[model samples]
Each structure stands twice: as C-alpha cells, then as structure tokens.
Target: MQTHAQIDGFDPERIERDVRRWLERAVIGFNLCPFAKAVYAKHQVRIVVSDASTERALLEQLGEEMALLRDTPADEIDTTLLVHPQVLGDFLDYNDFLDDADALLEALELDGVLQVASFHPHYQFAGTEPDDAENLTNRAPFPILHLLREDSVDRAVAAYPEPDAIIERNIATVRGLGVDGWNKLLGD
Candidate 1:
C-alpha cells in the first residue's frame, strides 16, 4: 500500500474525516441505517482510504480489504468502508463495476459470508430521475464500497423492527430535508 503522500492529494486522514461527517451528519444524523450508530459509536467501523486509479489496482485493494475483513475479529472491526477516490468517478461506470465486485465475492467463496453495499455521490436508483430527492439516500461525498459481515447484518436486521422500511424512511427523511437542508447538512 502506498503512503498518503505518495498518492497525489490522497489524504487518508482527510478522506476519513469526510466519511465520518457523512456517517455522523448524514447516516446517523438522518438515521438512514439504523444499525450504524452502534458500530460507529463503538469505533468498530474501519475506514480504508484507497488511492487506486485503475480498475486493476482497485480490485487488488479490494482483495486486500476482503482478506483483512475475513482475518480480523468482529470485535475489532465490525464493518469497513473502502473509500476509493481515484477510480470509478462516473456513477454509470461505478454502477457497472458493482457486478465485478459481486463476482469477486463469489470467486472468493464469500457470497454469503460477506456482502458489498454501494454508495456514491451520484447514486441514482433505476427508474428514478437524476434530480429525485430519493437518490440522496444513497448519495455520498464520494464513491464508497461498504463491506459488511453477513452475521452482523443479520443480527441487525433481526433486531430492526422492519428492515424493509429503511428505504422509504430514508426517502421520506431526505424529502423532508429537501435540497437546502441537505446542502446545509453537508456544509456546502
């Protein structure tokens, strides 16, 4: 892995801070992911800043992240956010790359053991317009590959009253916030 200084303008600390803001101000603040607060407050969420500029490089980093997540204990790390700044800037291109991520998990035989969730600045659900407020629910400051443990997710879902409602709830929350509210929350 290259040092932050080696990767042009790739400041891991800054990236981490930006992610934290998203988590605290958006995720936790809006209660988008109900289970996020516990892991975040416990400091179990791992934020990995990757400066990979190519698909191959990003995949290599993804391999390493999967290995780390598999090897590490749950107590030490419950989840990980693979924040890649250089690659997959275009939402459509990034959306396409998710297939590769799934394939990698399947190839590694971690399909059920691990799940990959996606978040991007321009996250747009299928059949939704670009300006739709519902899109903000999955939108982030940058492209993020959220690696989660199936066991943890299962537990969280089991505890959650209605896991399915999360989407509508998030949409409603963002809609209530509106564009100005979102901009203010993002400190834009």
Candidate 2:
C-alpha cells in the first residue's frame, strides 16, 4: 500500500491526528455513537489511512481491510476506520462509492458478517441541506469507511436501551449544538 506521502505528499501522521481528534471530540465527546467508546477505549478500533487516488484502488484497499477485519478477532480489532483522504474527497462521489463498497463485501462473502458505515467531511443525508445540523452526526475530518461486525452491532443494540432513538436523539443533540457549537467542539 502506498503511503499518503507517496500518493499526495500529505503527512499520514497529521491525517491520523486529525481523525483521532474528530473521533475524540466529535464522536465520543458528543456521544454520537454510544458503541464507539467501548471499543475505542479498549484499543480495538483500527485506524487505517489509505493513499489511493482512484476509486478502483480505494476499493482494492477496502477489500483488503475488510478481509483483515474478518480474519482478526473482535477483541483484538472490533472495527476499522479506513480513511481515504485522497480518493472520493467529494461528498457525492464518496456517497456513490458506498454501493461499490457494499458490493465488494458481498463479492467477498462478508455481507452477513460485516457492514460498512460511511462518514465524510461533508456528509449529508437525503433531503437535508449541506449545512444542516443533522449532517454533523456523520461528519468527520476526512472520508472514512467504517467497517463493523454485524454481531457486535446486534450485541450493542440489544444491550443499549431504546436503540431506536439513537438517530432521533443524535439529530436533536446536534441541532441543539448548532453550527457554531459544532465547529467549536471540533476545534475547526
């Protein structure tokens, strides 16, 4: 795999730092994903910075990351954040690439075992405007393909109270935060 420096002359360390900051400040700090803190605190979340500049190359790396996660134990690596800063930088392109990502999971016979969640710097939901507060729930420092285990998700949902309210609660939470608060929390 090519390093970010080799592909775009960007510092991988700084990219990772930014991702970690987003995870800590926005995701964990805001309680955006209740399941995230446990795995992250356990050091079971794998953060990979991909250097692919093309969709095909990024897909190849995604496949490899999926396979690795499949082979690895959940205790050792429960989830993976594949941050591809080079390719699919555009939100629409990144949104479209999710289909290909899922198809790759099916092709690899990992559809039932694992799933992909997406987070981009400018993630927007259907019918939501670009600057909508709800979008902040999915925003990150860069484009990240979050690979998760279905069993883990099921366990988390079963353990948590009112799992169905997560989305609604997140929307309300971000709306309460407002754009300025969100920016301040993320140190943007």
Candidate 3:
C-alpha cells in the first residue's frame, strides 16, 4: 500500500477529490458512462494513488494493483483506478504505454480477466486534433490507469440496449458539450 507521504508534487487528497469530482460531475452527472453510477453508488471503486516517477516504476505499481485486485473478491472491490501523477504526463506516452500494459496482462495470464481503460487530461482519438471536443469524453484531471473486470464489462454490455452505440453516443455528447462548456465544467 502506498502512503500519502510517498506522493510528491501533487497532493494525494486533491487527486482523490478531483477523481471523485470527475466521476460524479462529469462521468455520472453527464451520464457519459452509463455503467459508472451503479458501481460508484455501490462503493466498489478502488482509487489507488501511486508515486512512480518512471514508466518502469509505474508498471511495477500496476502489477501490484493487478495482484491486489485479483486477490480481492468482486463483491468487496469491483474495479480500481491506478492513479499515477508522476509518469506518463504526455498523452502520447501514456497511449504508447498501454501496449506494454497489455503485454503485462498477458504475462500475468490475466488477459481475459482484467483489462485497462485509459483516461488523460489530453485524450485524443486517431485523426483528431489535440483540442478536439470529442476527446474530452476520456479526459480527466490527470492520467489514469483504469483497471476493470472483464466480467463486469461483459455484463454491462450485455445489459445495455445498444452497447455498440456507446462510443457514438459519447462522442455526440462530448461534441454537444463543446470546448467552452467542457472547460467551464473542468473549472479551467
């Protein structure tokens, strides 16, 4: 377990608060991710603050988090956010690290059990500009390694009326919010 004293530069409390704000205000408030509210309401979201300053350290931390998640029961903890503020500040670097993340999952033999979804302050889609409004859908106050259970995702997708439409709907939702609106919501 990482202690508060371990984190440097950014305050751990503030990171937790910001993550909650992003989850409650943006994700759940805007209904961007329809499944978020249920898990959040259930208090099953585990937010871990990591102090890794390098990609190698972050990967080690990620491995620890994955092991923790695997050891814990689903009823006790459904998901985890490996919130790292030190490394992968650049969106491109974070994006590239995801490949290694996948490889780690395979190495751990957890490829089908758990998967990572990414969120960053500057999340961008292919062929889209950095400032594109649609990217805000995945944007957060800091770069986040969202580890999710594959079973939960499958259940959510199976229950959703139009799971395939989720991306398009989220894109339209973000586009409708626009840059100015998003900035205001983000308190920029």
TM-score of each: 0.94, 0.95, 0.93
CA shift of 153, model 1, Å: 0.7
For all candidates in order, the CA lDDT equals: 0.90, 0.93, 0.89
CA lDDT, candidate 1, residue 23: 93
List the candidate 3 regions with Cα displacement exceeding 4 Å. Answer: 1-8
Best by TM-score: 2
- Tens-digit lDDT track for model 1 on 39-143? 999989999988799988998899788878989999899999999888999999999999999999998888998999999988999999988899999888889
Ranking by lDDT: 2, 1, 3
Model 2, 83: alpha-carbon shift in Å? 0.2
TM-score, candidate 3, is 0.93
Put down candidate 2 lDDT per residue, 21-88, tens digits, no spaces: 98998788888999999999999999999878899999999999999999999999999999999889
lDDT of 3: 0.89
lDDT of 3 by residue, 81-186 (tens): 9888878999999999999999999999999999999999989989999988889999998899999999999999999999888888888988998988887886
Worst 10 residues of 2 by lDDT: 3-12
